[model samples]
Target: MDELVERVDAEDRVLGVVSRRDAVREGWLHRIGVVVCRDGQGRYLVHRRAEHLSRFPGHHELAVGGAVGVGESYEGAAARELSEEMGVRATVCLRFTFLNRSGLSPHWLAVCDALLPEAVAPDPREVAWHGWLTEPELRQALGQKTFTPDSREVFDRYLASRAAPATVRNRCP
Candidate 1:
């Protein structure tokens, strides 16, 4: 499949056109997938990207992620990537959205969360390694540079949304 692409300004406004690969490579405009998985114990799953990935290779990230394809909804891309990368199925529940414009490739990120029954089988091609971590552990990982900038933002947002009393109550009930 052709990589998804977008045109945008310094402020991330639609401007012209470009290829998604170029956006990531050249730091243009693209979309990112942010998937959050929570286990029964309330811990979240995180993974390290494969060293072979073009960008931020070997960086820690959420359990599954990818670029949003052209004409594909963020939820769809998240679901597809989650299944492909982790061998875990889930219905993506959109939790946060952000537009990052300072990077070489600006991007609109759609972050989603889901619950899983157990640890997933990680595809070696996509994920180098993975583990379950609590919110504090994840924060420490961020401070230690274990997570990429994009993943850090997503993790922070996911934690904030999930920690809200209303959200937690609804999930447990």
Candidate 2:
């Protein structure tokens, strides 16, 4: 079954609704919500994409998520994805960090952050392997060609935010 997703513009204004396949094949700008999961120790939950995925198969992703459905808020999508892909509920608010664009994918990505207090149970269909990594470790891993393009962009932006000063980071919405 084709998943229904909201098509949007470069600025993320909704243009219409379309099938996920059409959104990709026709290069329609669509929204996807990503949740950056962190453990109590501040290690990030990184996972390898399932090999059977249609795009970026066997690549690493900094978060678990998917396209936002029609009439769904980014936060809602992020929460849903966190549950569906990782089987973990975020006890705190998933802060909307930033928007990332790869120019390689039609997805207008909304990145969020959540500190999960529960254990993760990655779904086999979306994640093949999972692990926790520190900032330096994630950056080093990103140097290799293992991460998906979109994921790389998202993680890079996230690391940049963390490195910025308190005031500077606060300026980001």
Number of the predicted model whose lDDT against the real structure is largest: 2
Model 2 lDDT at residue 84: 88
In order, how many clashes per candidate?
3, 0
Tell me the TM-score of model 1. Answer: 0.81
Cα RMSD for predicted model 2: 2.7
lDDT of 1 by residue, 40-132 (tens): 898888888899987778888764777776666778888899999998888877776678653346687777778887768989998898898
- Candidate 1: list runs displaced more than 4 Å: 6-18, 102-104, 163-173
Tens digits of per-residue lDDT for model 2 on 1-173?
Answer: 99999988877788888998898888788988888888888888889989998878999988778889999988788899999889888742444444455634567777777887647898899889999988788888888748877777787677777677866665333
TM-score of each: 0.81, 0.87
10 in model 1: Cα distance from truth in Å?
8.4
Model 2 stretches with alpha carbons more than 4 Å out: 91-104, 163-173
Check candidate 1 and list the clashing pairs.
27-104, 27-105, 28-105
